[model samples]
Target: MIYLDNAATTRTAPEVVEAMLPYFTEQYGNPSAIYSLGSAGKKAINEARRTIAAAIGAKPEEIYFTAGGTEADNWALKAAAECCAGKGRHIITTKIEHHAVLHACGYLEKNGYEVTYLDVDRDGILDPESLKEAIRPDTVLISVMFANNEIGTIQPIREIGAIARERGILFHTDAVQAFGQVPIDVEEMHIDMLSASAHKLNGPKGTGMLYIRSGLKIRSFIHGGAQEKGVRAGTENVPGIVGFAAAVRRALSRMEEKAGRERELRDYLIRRIEGEIPYCRLNGHREKRLPGNVNISFRFIEGESLLIMLDMRGVCASSGSACTSGSLDPSHVLLAIGLEHEEAHGSLRMTLSEENTQEELDEVVGHLAEIVQRLRDMSPLYEDFMKSRRDRT
Candidate 1:
């Protein structure tokens, strides 16, 4: 099968797996234990922390390991709110954030905190001026994503961080999709809190990290043993952490080469799809986009139906629809970008990986063009468009 959904998750790299295998078997000891084997495990954890910290220009002590991006996001928001409880009760974020941040904000709102969800422009970008306008005296935190997951639009995080720093509000960014794909320096960005997931960068699942700037006082989100300097409480998954560090190292070391290759293939796919397909529109920014993301909306067909068709042809892709409470609803991210309900329903997200080749891109474009045409032929919207065209003729 041709896998094209790297944004959701990536396949673990062989080197990462090799680096983790020894820990799962030979180094099978709790990091908190004091015996020789356990000491080795503890040392491994510390090294992983240092590696990950260096990747983002943070101190090893400031990096707190968690279950994944969701947990990190939760910890960042909850801890920030609790730390500044005496100072304020308001937060700011964008509408295009992952559900992790949005739901956390929702929970905060229910508990008497105020939150401002800023709108995005047509290109799915949050205006820095709009963010400045949203800040009130009570606003204590600002959370925005480093890059959008579905549409691949990179936000003006450095500008937003500067704004937040000048205002004395804490800045947090969900960098789950941007960590391995782009260059990040927390010190230069002035980010107080940052979230990253291992699986998104070809490392193991169930492992991630939250970077909290040192000297910042934040309450603990989890209470148990003093695993992560009392900031997070849990037994360390030694294997996953090792794999995460290895993956981060490899991805960063080869980022320039991988990025160039992925961009070439991505541009090839986009050009072919737009030139060969009918009644389709590309979503997200044309140039300032991720190296391996292509989101498109076919005018007449539902995204789910097209996805199934592509799957049948051995191609994997995703739609922006959600199965919430057993009812299918259009994706909030799609709607937030100004797509109508029906238009949003027709959205397809195709994320590429560096491993994909030009041959794979060719096959995917060919299959997707066929599937979209087949689905549009049965669409009522297509009939309407045809009728309108005939009337104009």
Candidate 2:
């Protein structure tokens, strides 16, 4: 199969698996325990923390392990809101954020905290000026994503962070899609909190981290024992954490080469699809997007139908986020980027990995063109729209 859904999740690397095996059986003690086996577990967790910290220019003490990006996001949004309730109960975020942030904000709103959802430009980029204008005397935090998962448009996080810093408001970024694939420095970006997931970078599932800058204090997320510096409590997933660190090290080591290759292939696919298919438009900024992301909307075809057709042809892709796959509604991200409901419903997202090849992508593009054409032919809406255009001309 031609797998092109890396944004949903990646195949765990063999090296990461190798590094995790010993922890599963041999060193299975809890890090909170004081015995020798537990000591080994604690050591491994610390080493993983340090490795992950260095990769993102954070100190080891600032890294707090979590179940995954969703948990990290939940913790960041909720805890920050609660932590600064006295300062203000208002939070700011973009409309194109992953549901993790959006839903968390929804919860906050139901519980007395007010949230401002900023709109993105047509290319799916949030404006720093908009954020500045949205900030009020009661605004306590601004949580914007580093890169949009559906459109892959990279946000101007540094500029947004600067705005927040100048206002004494905390800044948080959900970097689930951009962490391992793109370069990031929390300190340089003035980010107070950043979230990342290991599974997105060829590491084990159920493992992620939240970076909290030194001197920043958020309330506890999970409560039980004194794990994760007493903030996130629970027995650590030693193996998953170890594997996460291994994957981070490997991904960063070859990030430049992998990104370059993926960008070439992504550009080629975009050109091919747009050239071969009529009434299809590419989504997101052409140049300021993720290196391996290709999102396009076919004018008359439904995204679900196209996804099924592509899957039958041995192509693994997505219409939107895996988290919201089965929903009948159009993608919020697409709609937030100014697409009409029908246009949003017809989008396709193909996120690649370094393992994909030019030949494979070319073949996928051919299949896609044929499939889209066939679907459009079956669409009465498309035929009527074309006839109307001809009549107007």
Candidate 3:
């Protein structure tokens, strides 16, 4: 299959698997134990933490491991809320955030916290000025995504973080989609909290990390064993952590090279699809988008129908966020960008990876053009368009 949904998750690298195998078999020991084997496991986990911390320009002790991005997001938001409970009960975020953040915010609202959901522009970019205006005296935290998973639009994170810093409000970013694909320096960005998942970057699933600035005084979201420096508690997934670190190292080391190739391939696919297929419009920012993402909306055809056709042709893509793919509702991201419900239903997101080649992209473009045309031909919307054109003539 020609996999094109890297944004959902990536294939674990062979090197990462190799690095993790020993931890699973020979070094299988509880990191919390005081024995020799436990020391070995603890050493591996510490090294992995250091590696990930260095990659993102964070201190090792500031990193807390978790089950995945969802948990990390929950921890960051809830912890921030608890830390400033006496100070404020207001939070700020965009309308297009992943469900993890959105749902958490919803829960906070029900619990007496006031939330301000900022709207995005036509290109799916949140306005920094809007964020500034939305800040109230009770605003305690601001959470924005580093990059949109649906359309791949990079946000003005540095500016947003700077604003939050100037105001003494904590800044949190959901960097799950941008962690390995783009450069992230927590110190430079002034980010107080950040979340990332291993699986999105070709590491093992069920592994993620949250970066909390030192001395933030946030409450623990999990309680039990004193793992993750007492911030998160659970049995450590030593093998998964090992694999995550290996993947982070490889991704950072080869980021520039892989990013260049991804940009080329993504551009080629977008150009081919828009040029060859009629009534197709590209989504997201043209210049400030992700190197590997190409989201498009084809008029007169549904995204689910197109996805099934592409799957039959051995091409894998997605219509919306992986977490909400089963839901029939139009994507919140698309609606935030001003797409009508019907138009949003016609959207398809294609995310590339380093493993894809020009030949594979070309094949995908050809198959997509054929499938879209076939489906549109059978659509009543297309038939009505033809009738209108005949009347105009």
Residue lDDT tens for model 1, 205-234: 999999999989988888988888887888
**Could you give candidate 2's per-residue lDDT for residues 220-314 as a string of tens digits?**
99888888889998899999999999999999999999999999999999988888888888899999998999999989999899999899999
Q: What lDDT tens digits, residue by residue, belong to model 3 across residues 68-155?
A: 9999999899879977989999999999999999999999999889999999998889999999999999999999999999999999
User: What lDDT is obtained when candidate 2 is compared to the true structure?
Assistant: 0.94
Worst 10 residues of 3 by lDDT: 225-234
Task: Output the TM-score of candidate 3.
Answer: 0.99
Give all candidates' CA lDDT scores.
0.89, 0.94, 0.93
Q: By TM-score, rank the candidates, best first.
A: 3, 2, 1
TM-score of each: 0.98, 0.98, 0.99
- How many clashing pairs per prediction, in order? 0, 0, 0
- Between candidates 1 and 3, the lDDT winner: 3
Model 2, position 129: C-alpha lDDT score: 86
RMSD of each: 1.5, 0.9, 0.8
Candidate 2 deviant stretches above 4 angstroms? 390-393
